[model samples]
Target: MKTVEKIERKLPVLKTRKRVAAYARVSMESERMQHSLSAQVSYYSALIQKNPEWEYAGVFADYGISGTVTKKRDEFNRMLAECEAGNIDIILTKSIQRFARNTVDLLNTVRHLKELGIEVRFEKENINSLSGDGELMLSILASFAQEESRSISENVRWATIKRFKQGIPNGKFTIFGYEWQDDKLVIVPDEAEIIRWMYAEYMKGASRIEIGRALMERGIYTRQGKPWVDSNVKVILTNITYTGNMLFQKEYCEDPITKHRRKNYGEMPQYFVEDTHEAIIPMDEWQAVQAEFKRRRDLGPFGNKSLKLSAFSTKITCGCCGKHYRHSGKRNTAGEVYYVWTCQTKSQKGASACHSKNIPEKMLQNATAEVLGLDEFDEDAFSQQIEEVIVIGDDTLTFRFYDGHEVTTKWQSTAKTDWWTDERRKLWGERHKRKDTNPNKHLFYEFTGFIKCGCCGANYRCQSGKRKDGTPTRSWYCTGPKDQCHNPGIRDETMKRLVTDVLGLDEFDEAAMDAQIENATILDHTVTFHFRDGHTESRDFLDKRHGTPWTEERREKARESMKAAWTDERREAMSERIKKIRSEKKWPNP
Candidate 1:
């Protein structure tokens, strides 16, 4: 227990000798107002020091800040701290509203200062906090000030909402990839390149995580000169602003009293302004991206959010614990934030389930590409290289790999590769096997190889892919018997329709494909094979010789002969077929 410090000196005597401090606040830090604040501080210090009856404590002014809220005004808080430290006995301010426009805040703060023997004087209000009944009148006036402040805030919001409904562009945050000249966005050539790269990568089936890494690797930075991040890339992908359009009032204050802003997709009228700014992404590309985003969004619960590749997620596979890593974002300078992938297992279980590990988004993307055997995601280069790999396998058909190794264009190299020995063939097959089993698998050329009727000598062109159109005319067209399989080979498109129909894949998009793959475990028995061109053929492998002249006797003899044959030629053919079958295998788990 300690004895209380008594006020041995009376207020009249103290008022004549006590150090007096003053506080002031200005809403903006304009040159003129800054000068005025400085003058006030100097004047008070000089006036107090010159007076023999008073001592100069200090003049604290919060410049370029609001007085309505004391929380953000550091200068005011410092003065309060000084008072608590027993450095000053009195505080002088311009008015009650200036002291604090918040009624509750004003009263509580003044009452606190008074208890520490620090009296606050509102010169305009002609009231001192320590005087009897002075606080009662101050609270009533402060309440009026607070109410006035609320009225101002409401008017601002109403005006903003009105402007939003009118499709007016408002606010100060500048859009990246565009320069604002005369209040309109114009494409900044350099920044626009980065934006274009983002959309291009995304359209080429790169995920947000991949896009972020690509940007960082290219020495590209955000509008704020910081490293790229997945969430930031996602935002860039989703923002219609890059399409030269915008939605005004996408978010609004959820709590009018507390002023908490939230997405107002349901509550407010959304205004879309198209071609309002110069485009960073083409309208067609933007449409494609948005279509993809909506398709992913419709996947529900298991949306593309989970598809994000965090740094740790790509490299670290859970041998026992199967939980995957997750990603998170944080704000940095320039009001931008970066995202990082982290081990969600550790985050949730606190090292019980897994260890805490994090990886940068860029690193993950590079690792994934490398794992997928696509060390360089240069589309042209990849296309050329893969084509080169395919051409060396067969020469009679003139089938060209799009990987730039066109047999016709690079015939000399193709001829050399075709002469690969048995050992070389085995090595090539092994390399391809490794590529297929890579965990960071990319969906490039997952469909490919073989569509021919052996009996007709009719080499049908088996298309392994299709266009975006929802028709079945795209699959295997009998180029006609070079040409013996008389049945005009089915359309590649028709093959996809037939296979999808049988597999119940009604949705014909990447998202649908992803879903089919995910549910593959449940439908693992519903086997099928997808061609490199995106055509799917059932894995039933039935021997249906439609074009063969198969009399009953000949058919029986062929089957019996096939069973007994074990020559080196037969073995060689079987080896090639086995290699091809393994090369063309798919999860079919869906």
Candidate 2:
């Protein structure tokens, strides 16, 4: 059949054009380098368009960007994105160093492109990244480039160190009160005036925060036109450069790749060049300010410029935890604000860390006055006499004197009674008066504030809820932390009956109870009643549960309700939840 046909058919082959893009970069910013970059972009654009087998994919050029890191190069990243999108078949670059100076980055990028069926052709080295020996050649050449960059960085650092030894600045810096002129620091008249004022204020005992506030009020800002802050003010106050001196290498770049600068705390050599600039603040005044800073620092927390120091601040120490006492103000139940000194450990970490009790400011003053044999507390006299007040226990203070004498005094805190004035007591009575909505308010409600837990010394909290039989139930328990107190809860009916028996009343009478009883304390199995006439009576506490007793009929109703609630879906969900919990607990199936 083939011999008979003897005819040949030809098929036209379609020529597919390769999409090509080029990348160019210059490390440094300059007019000549910018022109070079422009020429490179133009040449690559024309070269790609002129080639018949190549389609013109845009040229990506990064100017004044380091090739060691590809993240900062926007156009280079865009070209990579195009290659990943299967748009660019080949990437043309001037050299491997121009693509990436980092050896690992170069290899990783090239291999990634190769996986995407893209090729990178370096014009200068005549290397194709898709070729068999591409990665080996790229690794060797990129290592050379990285070494070259490191060598250049080291040379620059050496030159800078040499200049530092000669007391020459590495470069003109942007200082707050000075400007760079002719490669030298020159004083800016207006900013110099502000700096001078800041130094004067600091010498006059004005705090940095105060100086910053004054500057903000006057609408005076930093050289960068930002509002002056305490930190900025402190910088001006402490900077020795303002005294016509310069300190170089206070910070140094720790890494060439990350460019992380670390503060030089004797990690490297520092050069302090005097008379490097005109003086904004005189040297003598600057020295005085530094001395004052040291004095304040030695004073500890009392010297914090923002805090108004009290006579007791930094003067009291917790004997148990050996930590300073922190001043904290608290509002009592009567809404009266009073200050107390608490151990810093207890205040910050909690009572578990330090079990020191808080001493009221008034109690501390009274104890100091008694220890000094003074009729009244005098801060000036106390400061002159007492070096430190050590809180020994809950109610004792040990005062150490500067003259090497010590005095121990027992002091009780009357802060509770001191807060309860006649008016406050009347207000409290009015606040806790029973509302008319409750039918049994007169019976159990009258015992609310009167009943206290002896275990934790906390007022009992009244709780009311409905039982399973839909009957309302009331009980009283300590308001203290449940884990710590362990005081048993008492039924409302039990408490009312105990009070009635203690008052010798035929039935519960709120009026008579209030008239006779001052307060009542509940201890373990005992209820002690303090009478208004100064007589105390004790009765054994009866722990009785008050609710509708669970009868056979009620049990049957509960069982029927349980059966109704346990549907097939609910049972399955319950089974799954139990299975998950058992698995989490690593328990074997039962």
lDDT for 145 in candidate 2 is: 89
Report the lDDT tens digits of candidate 1 across residue range 368-403: 344336655444443333322111111111223334
- Where model 1 places Cα greater than 4 Å from the true spot, the runs are 1-16, 29-47, 165-167, 254-259, 298-346, 349-590
TM-score of 1: 0.49
Candidate 1 Cα RMSD after full superposition onto the native fold (Å): 29.6
In the range 149-177, model 2's lDDT, one tens digit per residue, is: 77877888899999999999888777898
Q: Give candidate 2's root-mean-square deviation (CA, Å).
A: 16.8
Which residue pairs in candidate 2 have backbone atoms (N, alpha carbon, C) closer than 3 angstroms, thus clashing?
Answer: none
- Candidate 1 lDDT at 482 equals 43
- Compute the lDDT for candidate 1: 0.63
Error of 1 at 134 (Å): 3.0
